[model samples]
Target: MKTVVITGAASGMGLSATKLFLAKGWKVMMADFNQEAGKKTADELATRYSKKQVAFHKTNVADSSSVKELKNATAKFFGVADSIINNAGIFTKGALHEVSEENWDRIMAVDVKSIYLMTKYFVPDMIKQKAGTIVNTASISGLTGDYNMAAYNAAKGAVVNLVRAMA
Candidate 1:
């Protein structure tokens, strides 16, 4: 069976995708920073689908070591990944002048660096296998600026361009 690895798989779009993929008969490796949510989602999926088709790995995509471990774990669990969805992100809202450096860095780390880290580790495996797909989730806020969300908008804009660069 084909396997798909989805980051941020504990909630929102990532979680929804996990369910859809399982329903369609794909082995899904759910990666999320929230261990409780990730484990819960995995258990729920396993119960609904079957234990053989779902697995969960606690992952914090902003950290390089964590992303590397996630890649290794997924490879060990499923042999290879046919696709990856980089969907982990965090948003911070404030005026550009009012945004603290800490908040800026945090947003950039989660919303932008996470994608880079995931690609750094996973793309090599994908290339070696000679077949793979990657999907990155970016918001309209990234495409068009929004009030009081300068930092988030900038980070997500970076994501949009990064996806284009990867493509």
Candidate 2:
């Protein structure tokens, strides 16, 4: 069976994708920073679809090492991943000049750096296998600037362009 690895798989769009994939008979490796939510989601999915079909790994997408570890764990659990969805991100809104450095960094780390880290570790395996797909989530705010959301807009804009560049 084909396997999919999805970052931020514990909730929102990621969680919805997980459910859809499971319903479609795909093996899913759910990665999220929220241990409780991740574990709960995994347990529920496993119960619904059998343990062999669903698994969860707690991962901090902003950390390169964490992302590498997640890739390794997924490989060990289900062999190389057939696809990856870089769906993890954070939205922090503030005026461009008013945003704190810490908040800006956090947004950038989660929204932009997460993709870099995941692709850094997972893309190589995909390339070696000679077939795989990557999907990244970006918001409409990225395409058009929004008021009082400069940081989020900037980070999402980067993601949108990055996705195009990857394609």
Candidate 3:
């Protein structure tokens, strides 16, 4: 069976992808920062898809060590992942003067740096196998500016271009 790592898999697009991958007969490692939600979702999915097909790992995508740990866990649980969906993201909107520096940094870290971290940690196995896929979820906000959302727009914009560069 194919293996996949999907960040933010507790909800939203990540959750949807988890379900779809399970339906397609792929083993899924569901990574999320929300431990309770992540565990609950994993348990429910396991009931539907069997425990062997679904597992959960709590992850903070903004942290390098956390991402590395996720990679380690994936390898231990299901061998090399055939794909990773970098779907974890947070949205914050504020005027340039109103946005805190910390908020700006967080936006960049979670939205952009997470992709870099995941690629750094997981792509090596793909290279060794001569096959892999990376899916970075970017928004229309990335292509167009938003009012009071400079930080979010900038981060997503970086993700957009980074996806291009990776391609």
lDDT of candidates 1 onward, in order = 0.91, 0.94, 0.95
Instruction: Please count the clashing residue pairs in each candidate, in the order shown.
Output: 0, 0, 0
Tens digits of per-residue lDDT, candidate 1, 12-110, equal: 999999999998999999999999999997998899998889999999898999999999999888878899999988888789999999999988998
lDDT of 2 by residue, 86-112 (tens): 998888777999999999999999999
All candidates: CA RMSD (Å) = 0.9, 0.7, 0.6
In model 1, the number of clashes is 0
User: What's the TM-score of each model vs. the native?
Assistant: 0.97, 0.98, 0.98
- Score candidate 2 by lDDT: 0.94
